[model samples]
Structure formats: C-alpha cells, structure tokens
Target: MTLRTSAVQESWGPTAVWSCAHAQGEHVKFFVLGSVGVSHGGPVLTGGPPQQQATLAVLVLRAGHVVPLHELTAAVWGESAPGSAVMILRTYVWRLRKLLEGGEPGKTGAQILESANDGYRLAVPRGSVDAVRAEELAAKATRAHAAGELEVCAEALAEAGSLWRGEPLAGVPGPFAESQRSRLAELRLHLLEERLGVDLLRGRHERAVPELTALIREEPLRERPYGLLMRALFAAGRQGDALAVFGRAREVLADELGLDPGPDLRLLHARILSGDPALLPAAASPAPGRGGGLPAPLPAAPSGSAPTSPAAHGAATAGGPARGGAPAGLDGFPAASAG
Candidate 1:
C-alpha cells in the first residue's frame, strides 16, 4: 500500500495525518503530531511502547537527524544504563518499526529508523513532529502580534499552548530532555504573556485577573505577569489590591534578583500613588493634551544615498539610516536611553 496527497501539506491534524500516510510508499512518512501515526497508507498503525515512544521522542525532538546511540541511551537510562544498552535500543527501534508498519504481531515493520555509523536518524521531512508544529504556531503568533493582528494572535498562541500532551520527553531522563523542557516551558510562558498583553490592551482586564494570578503563582520571578495582574486589579476598581500586587512584586524581585523592578513597574507604582487617571483606560490622560511627551524628532536621513551607518545614528532613530554611512551590520542597533 502507498500514501500520497497534498493534504499532508495543509494545517496538521487527523486529516493531514491521513493524507500524509495514504500517499504512495514513495511519499510515506512518520508523523508524531498530537499522537503517533504511520503515514505509509493513510495512518495505519498507531501507538508505541513506553521505551519505544521515548526513543522516538528523542529522535523526533532532534528532528530527522542522527542521534548518537550513547546519547540516546543516556537520555533514557541516565548514568545507570544497562550494559546491553545498544541491544535494548535496537529492540526498541524494532518495536517502533513494527508499530509504524501496521504489520501483524510477529510480522516485520517498515524501515523508518535508519542506522548510521554512530547513531540513528528519524528520516522524516520537516513539519512532521507535533512539537515542531507547536513551535511554528508560536512563531507565527509572535509575528501576528508584531503585525497588530491581535485576535488572530490570541488564537495562534492558544494553538501553540495546546501542543503539549504532557511534559516533553516525559519518562525520558537526560540533560537534553531537561533543556528541551525548560526552553519549551519558557516559550509557553512568553506566549501566555503575549496573549494576556493583547487582552489587557483591549481593556479585558477583568477577564485576565484569574489567569494572571495563576501565572504569577507559577512564575513568581517573572515581572510581566505581575504587571498584568496589577493592571487587571486597577481596572477592576480594586486599587488597594493592585498596590499590594506591586508591593509583592517589589519584594519578590529584591529577594530573588537583588534588584528593583524595571521602568514599567516603577512607572506603575507612581501612577498608583499619584492616582494617574490614565492608569484606567476609561479615564483621559492627566496631562493638558491627549498626546504624551513626544521625544525629539528623528535626525534626517543620511544624505548622498550611500547607506548611512546604523551604528552612527542615535538610539532614537535606530531604524533610520546610519549617521556616518559605514557598512551596516548586525551591530547597527541604536543605543537605548537611560530612564
């Protein structure tokens, strides 16, 4: 049997799994989206043993690349690995192949895990792993925020948040899995913050408080969630609660980082103390006019059209052309002003 179709190219889901597996054997591929499914002929065999799943997790996380046998064994067994680690790994691989091929209990499975001189390769194309898809959704959500597509941004963030079945590489123990877990967790936090930021901007503060409170509980050291909590409290007409939240944040920062809160937090504290009406979106700015104090006008573009040096330009106009027309490189970021 063979699986072939363009549906595999669309947004990943059960349908995409079916399409990818149903194509021809020529298009056969392994996909580990929300669940494991073999795509040789429309998602035939699904599921795998714990050890086999762990082995595939390491490879899929590595994503179509050779993972050294030693490294793979270490990830699964840590320092007390068995003497027959290679044999055991081979057995796991054999089982995974059988699961993928949909063969009878005793029949041979498809050839998915390819052996290399020192390791094994997953050998699937890009976008086959659900984790990869989750990361892609996160990146797209970030871009949507940058582009000011707030509603779409929230949906994308939610989609990214939904990718995890549990702790990544769960049951797998090693430095690699630990690092991946930490990185993915941090990204999840950032996406959550982005979603909350959009909701706060839209004056949906009341709806954000519960979520923000839970987030702050999980990440006490992160000031962004505290800031959102404060905003939500202030908007909800609980000024005292908002002030208490600020105090808590200040104490946590001092205890954890031995430093004071950043500019945003300091500004918020002053606003609360002085009763800055602008703190509440429904109120108008306290200043004479609606416009906040505008910074100095940006310098004129470098004349002579030779491409201004990004480094030569002042911090305010980092996006503008270089001041001295030097070769622009990554180091061309404008200097930031001190508060």
Candidate 2:
C-alpha cells in the first residue's frame, strides 16, 4: 500500500500520545525529543537489539517521511554495509512494526508504521512526537519575541526547553544519529540565545549575566553570545567589565583565528565606549493581553524560500561544526524524500 506523507502541524497537548487508540484506549508513543527511544503507555519498550534500535532511530529522525532503502543502509552501516543490508533492514522494519502494533497480534493493516513506495514512514499524529512539538513551541517563541511579548516568548521557550530530556538520539550509534544529535544541539543553543535576547530586552540584564557568562565560556568564540555579554554587562552598569569583555573577545579572535570581531560586536563595543544611552536595556514591555499578546503562529517564509539554518546566523567557531557539513565524524544524510 502507498501511504503519502504530509506535514502535520497540530500542536501537542498534555496527552502526549498519538490519537490512534488501541483495545484499552492506550497507544504507543515514540519519543525522539531527547534520547532516541520509545515507550508504550507507562513502561519503556525494549528488546529490539542495537542494530534494530539504530534502524528505528534513522526512521524516527525523519518521521512522517519515506527514507529510501539505500539511504537507510548508508546511514546505518555507512560504507561498510554488509551484502545482506537490504534484507537485514527489512527485518528491522518488520520488528519495529510489530513493536508499535503490538496491541493487535497478527494485524495486517498499516496504521502506525506504514510502507511507502520504496521506503518506510512512521505515521504518528501531529504533535505526538516530542521533537515536532518542541519545534512548534520554538516557532511560537520566535513569534512572541518578535512582537515584544517577552513573557509569552519566555513561556514558550521554557516549554520548548523542557522537552529535551537529554542529548537527542543518545546511544544510537551511526553517522545519521551523530549528525542529527549535533543539529539538534545547535538548535537548542539557538533557542537558548533567543530566550536570552528576550531576557536582555526585558531589562533582566543582571539576571541574564550568569547565564550569558556561562554561554560565553562554553562557546568563547561565538560572537553573538559575546555581544550579548557585552550588552548585559553594560546594562548592569559594569562598563569596565563590558569593555574588558570586548577586549578579550578581540584578543581571542585575533590570536585563534587570525581575525577580528564581527561588525555587530564592534558596534556594541563602540556604543559601550561612547556610553550610548541606547546601550542601556529599555524598560520591560507590558505583559501580553495588556496592550500585548504577540499574534499566534509566527509569519512564514515567502513561497519557495528556505528558512535560514542556525549555522548561517553566526561565524564558525573553534570547536563547533564547520559550514554546511554534518558535524565532524557525523556523515550527512539526505533530506527526507516525499513518500
């Protein structure tokens, strides 16, 4: 049977399982928000074997899309795939379907895990997947922040941040898992930076200092965090510390990369030096609903346009992934092909 894949946009509510109920009103829930794993009802499901788990991870990473056989094999076994790779993969798919469809023994229908033309697709309802829900919340956070509804933005980001239980796809070994883990980690960092921006904009400069300091130390060469630190310090009336931050950033950039600070950092440094009143954090905007409330659902990119990747927002740093390549040791996989 041919099952066509489509984008599922519904938000995840408190009931975090798929709408597909079984004999007892329970359902299988597949989670990929943090660790690549699955649980049915209350207890975590197990006994699929490592290779099978790796196969499931590959499919879950691109849930709702058909990942072709060759691509699956490439992700799972890389260049060293055994001659029986295809057969082995098929067996893995069968096992996963059984695990997911365990409610009905010997069921022939493709309800959750459906077979596509040349690949497989896990057909869970919208928001059932934690990663998808987190993405939606992050999108909402972006929208709320743009509208200057700092509280709403913070709320949304907090919810999004809570979804991550640990490193994504943890313990699932493969090039695909490695790359996805890096991508998800970078996305989380971007979300954290966004929330930090909201904090600074809402005049929580002092409160943001500790977090920004930690981020800067963790990613010393990341210009955006350094810039944010400078702004936060200046807003906190520690102008000397702010300037010292700029000086240290300059030295680090020059010594490590044979480069200088980017224009944004340079401009902030100049503003701090000049005591620009604009450098001081503005008074917090009124809460949402009191002449507030950012519009629901952020604006979409123009037709046929791709939203910018997180990497494009900043310069490549010393220990981070380089431009346009699956993080070091993490081989890239093709985007999910339409089922």
lDDT per residue for candidate 2 within 1-339, as digits (tens), equals 111222332112232334443332134555654555565545556527767877887776566677789988988887899999999999988888777765333543266677888888766543445665566676676566556576887877766666676777667766666666666666666556656766766678899899988987877766666777787898898999999998998998888788887666677788789877656644432345666433223223112111123212122222331222211110011111100
Q: Which lDDT tens digits does candidate 1 get at residues 1-339?
A: 222333433224423332224212334444443344444444324446555666766776675567889988977677888899899999888777656553222223444566777988765543555556556665665566556576776776676665554454454444444555555444455556656766765578899999999988877876667767886788678889999998998898888878777666677777776665666654333344655432222123222212121112122212111122232111111111110
In angstroms, what RMSD does candidate 2 have relative to the true structure? 9.6
TM-score of every candidate relative to the true structure: 0.66, 0.73
Best by lDDT: 2
Q: Rate the local accuracy (lDDT) of all candidates.
A: 0.56, 0.61
For model 2, the stretches where C-alpha displacement exceeds 4 angstroms are 1-27, 46-48, 102-110, 283-339
Compared with the true structure, model 1 gives a TM-score of: 0.66
